[model samples]
Target: MTTQKNTDLPLQGERYISREFFAREWENVWAKTWLIMGRADEIPEAGDFFVEDIGPESILIVRQADTGIRAFYNVCQHRGNRLAVVPDGSMDTFTCSYHGWKWGLDGACLEAQDAEDFTPNPCGHAQLEELRCDVFAGFVWINMDPECASLKTFLGPIWDEWAAYPMEQMTRVQAISVRMPCNWKTVQDNFHETYHVATAHPLGLNSVEDDYRLTAITLYEGGHALGVTQGSIPARRKFGDNPSLGEQIRMELQTWDLNPDDFQGREYETRIALQARKRQLGPERGFSHYNKMSDAQLTDTFHYTVFPNFATSINSDGMLYLRALPHPTDPELCVFDCWFYAAGAENAYTRLLTENGDASRLAGPAPREWRNYGEGTLGVILDGDAVVMADQQRALHSRGYKGSRLAHQERRVQQYHDMIDRYMEGYRPR
Candidate 1:
């Protein structure tokens, strides 16, 4: 029971780069929360979409059928034009360069180009406007308030604490969005901290000893948030840090059996953790989260934020999405998606050696003066956490700064600034 580092909060760190709090956080927090707008396998098919913006809306998302997935408002209710402008394809309808307003693919508004433009069925009284879309856990949430609160009440407990992350049979090798300049709460204050992973990890930073307990700091109620940590098994076993202990015990028994194709093919991960260390027993009956990993901890480090924006890093040498996208009111001009995932069948040789960079930081793991005052090693963990989040967003528009407080181990950054101060205090709950 000892974990504290609020390090003086400063209102969710300067109202996350304010501009009168970014136009009242785009009308009380991105138009009534539940955000996370796309990635249902990136619009699987059937007229797909992928516009996304949500900070004063821009959406689209669509992916009808095969189990619906819709979101609209790329506009076209007729005299509002701007409908789908290729950023991602597939479309059975959606036309309106300036006149031809078609729509469909479940956004309705059938057609309206000529044939008398005054009633008598003007595209059945126009319809192309439905922004509610759901699909949590596989991702694709949206809500421009047509009667908010629902995405399981804005994913209260991170949809069952990420229900054993098979994350919809995981699939996605690269996505990288990028635009970066700053705020989005300075990238969630640099991923809420691993204490800057012994110097901002390029890789090496898992010295696993034990007891780190931070497992619960949720704040769900529209602007949802989550952060948890786990550490235990550490007795000693570092055959050169994770090299093929049966391919890390069949990828932790295929991420707890979402199926790594039944793991009976070949390299049964060092023949099942050397036969579960000769039947050790008891400890959630180890089938493999690297048998409660500890030779440098690797069983549960599950870091997920996703609230108010994004930040994901489910490990196993895979899955890493992290969006920010601010700057319409210039919260400091932002954008950064930084994604990566390499699924089964060695995802084409681990995505061709992560495209030759081999996940560089000079391929991590080297003493390099164990933070001897940091000359290198993850360049002091990405240069002292990007020089303390760019001088804390430049002394938060300094004038000799005034705000600062919150520290009970930064209660998840003050429950993400009291859930963005309960949506800048307007929380339209109807």
Candidate 2:
């Protein structure tokens, strides 16, 4: 499939606030599309598993003794009781707390109480309902629809391009989920375009090129989009003497023993210099993953949006994985998850930027944490985005708000919503 022209589907505000629209999405979009569960490395050992709650369903993904991963609906077949209640754990078999029905790691029913009493014994025949599961770019993906396309097919060209990064070798250093008072799409639309960066995240302009004209935006087939921008440089038109070398860039240059002052009038050259330095010193510094990446990959920010509800900003040595998940019932509420991964020596101290452009240091793998909006920071930039989402959710309800008047740079947003319409109209990818 090739990338299509801009879609003319109306982006009415009702889609963001209507219960009917949200219900349609659950049935037509969320239930059919491939979704990211978590990283494969999270469950390395046999029997290790994690539970991801998406929409109204709970999916249990486990690493089998055979070194393959499998996913199943976290429900007991006998009485429809949830099999795995907690987030994750390791066990020889999944024993249903309600009926003591034992299911093996492969999802086959091992034992059902008084099974012989029934017409046919469930032990040998019964099985947990399974979902299509696949691993790509180190992420465990699950699809609810039995007829859904393969993950590679659904991802299109993104599959091959992402192979250059050793994401599987990276370790997740930070995981945070926040409950937001807004529709899930509200969060997605925000990331689809950088047009709001100048106003919503002014501080980010110091380190990123936010000009839509300068950024390379590619809208791909299957609703995936990519935005590439020069990093470590100010977005301003003029590069005057003593150009701003934001704290992050200053610290980065210092790490390479490059004097920040020397790049005063030549700030635009910093990114190229930094890329060369990293390429030269990466392997010795234990960042061998850099060798597989191109110079642009070493310095530019490659922001990708996977159809439906996932976005990631990938840097040379780190990445910010973001997801906007729908609430179980409310059309006006959603869950936002932010995870940061870094490629370096195991347990090595590394500093990476969060989705909100804040530099965060990690010693090793970090545990997932939950927070409500306003309870704490999602990072300075993200906190601002959260506020905008909430406000947009409210504004979308007003009579004055007719529909979205999108800019050329926001074409990704248009394509995303158009894809949603296609799904709602029963269009499935072959």
Candidate 3:
């Protein structure tokens, strides 16, 4: 399990394709880690549910009588037919499609066809398997191991670092289901570095909106490393003349659109309000601007990772909610979903998400990088990410590239590897 150079320390090939390593991950990583289950707001009403799989288990995200979200095994205790087939919806209670067995959101087994045969009515004795469910930021996260760490400690100091962006404020713009060939880690790791930015998002680099890069990376002891980039630029310079240094700045000045007022005026205009704030705040200060703003000058982008399995991209206009769930026995084949949340652009959201008509204008090319994965696909964003991850998965199977080195400037990526090693090596136990 030795890694490559410090910059490229994470295992590329073996970790990606080895069934043995994938098993170890299920036991060590997926089984114990605080994995994201579903968006919190999606199931805000009572009895709403979404089925998500983590490693070897199918997690049923449930909305309780108290209007709180809970996680349960989506299995029937009697016959084991999957309870909820649809990915998401609302229900008074869940009835097994196979048998007429029923359970409430609290997981109480309320009904069984024949009660007399099973003695004490089968109500309290059999309940859907329950797991620890905690709501954080805007998503529901569940842990299979009841003895795992609290979400706060698991996230380390990410809150202070992400204090500014109004994460809850942004609406879910798009929710897309895309299945990729690569492991979830492959995609997550790919996103955790700007090392691939120059090549991966060359058009993304030179867009008119904002300049973003790696300076926003964060590494902690508990396998948590966040690499974010802002979409901002200087007053005199064009985009990319001097790219953004890190994730913090990306959170501050990235291109985000919000609910337009009656007159359609955002907090700040692109040239004056947004860039002025970035230049004034400078690069030294981490994003804690929510309290500092006058309420009129708070437009910003927030592309941040919340530990183990969630990454959020909040632009001034809207946001992209990304959830990476474990892929059962085949860790490399995890399910990735994206939800776009926008303030005033639900119309635009639907159009861009659907890639309605030649939407490539939405994504500007990166002048610095070159591997435009979703070339000529019109204008959908998820297609681009899917193309990149699937291709990376294919490359991982290749024997030609074992692993490589990382630049010291990419400390966040290094820190990410160190965290993974710490956990896999048995040093940091949840």
Candidate 4:
């Protein structure tokens, strides 16, 4: 059966640069969806907690004494003071720094200073308000909507396809959270389509089969979608015969332990060859997970976008997790998080080479480093995307600008907006 193409959902310029549009999203979209905040194993022990700021709300996700994860609004019950200012730490109980009202890990209000000052005691009855929290794919997920669907339900088919990869045991070796001067949707839209690679990521053609026929796009039951593209081989391009590009492809094959000389004229066959080589040598190299993966999983890239903000690209070698967060106030600004996870890096001797040839032993729940948008390195294609994003944000204000004329391959972008529109119209998961 053929997948139906999405209708062109008009994406207005105001939606990207207007304050009123952002406010609607805060209420209709951000407040109602399950968000993947961090890894569950990050707080393996009791009392270990981390704070995730979503729009104007700050949520405290903590490991309880019973070893289950819980989430609470990061606000003092009394007088609206903030709690847990630090990003992450371990503590027996959270005592409000403002007035010393203390709360246990389970969100029970244990103590309140000046206890006898009130007519009726508030300590025993009062507790920090709890939000729905759950764990899946090794990540701690939380929903502000108390009646929201379970994490597994929210994730739909994504939950099962993702299970093929050993996400639970992977290590986050590289992370960078940067503030960008573009609407959050810009980042999400960029990740949903491969058409841009022909121009935006020229070198990418040397590695991935970017042709539409070779790529399959699936729009799932929920707003979630995935674009699976056959990769680890050179795509047919005008530069296919370029000598320099051929050498680069050959070097990559050699690195994967596949001999470049074996497929000299037929470089496109390297992907299947590498997969066979990986299947033969993977187990000994500590790739315990590859044994469970399919042949496509061993060679191609399966990139998934989880509704409102999160996007992840999974493969046998590594996973790239990206999230676009709305800036608390500005429609023209958002925070973009980039995290790289390597599979089977627990074996110290086996090194995972990152996007820029930075081979390092990968392991984590690693700490994330913050950088200004134009500051530190974000690899090659991503850095280029960052520069264009700000300019894209600026161009959105042009009077001549019309709604996006999307290609069939870019149906996910239109569907994404269609999903957002559904949320705005009061559609919430039951």
For model 2, the run of ten residues with the poorest summed lDDT: 346-355
Tens digit of lDDT per residue, candidate 3, span 71-182? 8888988878888887778999899887699988888899888877887778878888898889876667788888877877777776455444444544443455555567
What TM-score, over all chains together, does every model reach?
Answer: 0.32, 0.94, 0.74, 0.93
Please write out the lDDT profile of model 1 over residues 125-209, one tens digit for every residue: 7777787778876778777887886777566676775654445555555554544456777767577545444444423222221
* Poorly placed runs, candidate 2 (over 4 Å): 1-6, 237-242, 345-349, 352-364
Alpha carbon lDDT of residue 162, candidate 3?
47
**lDDT (Cα, tens digit) per residue for candidate 2, span 74-119:** 9998889999999988989999999899999999999888888866
TM-score of 2: 0.94
Clashes of 1: 5
> lDDT winner among the candidates?
2
State the local distance difference test value for candidate 2.
Answer: 0.84
CA error at residue 355 for candidate 1, angstroms = 32
Off by over 4 Å in 4: 1-9, 238-252, 346-361
Q: What lDDT score is found at residue 187 in candidate 3?
A: 63
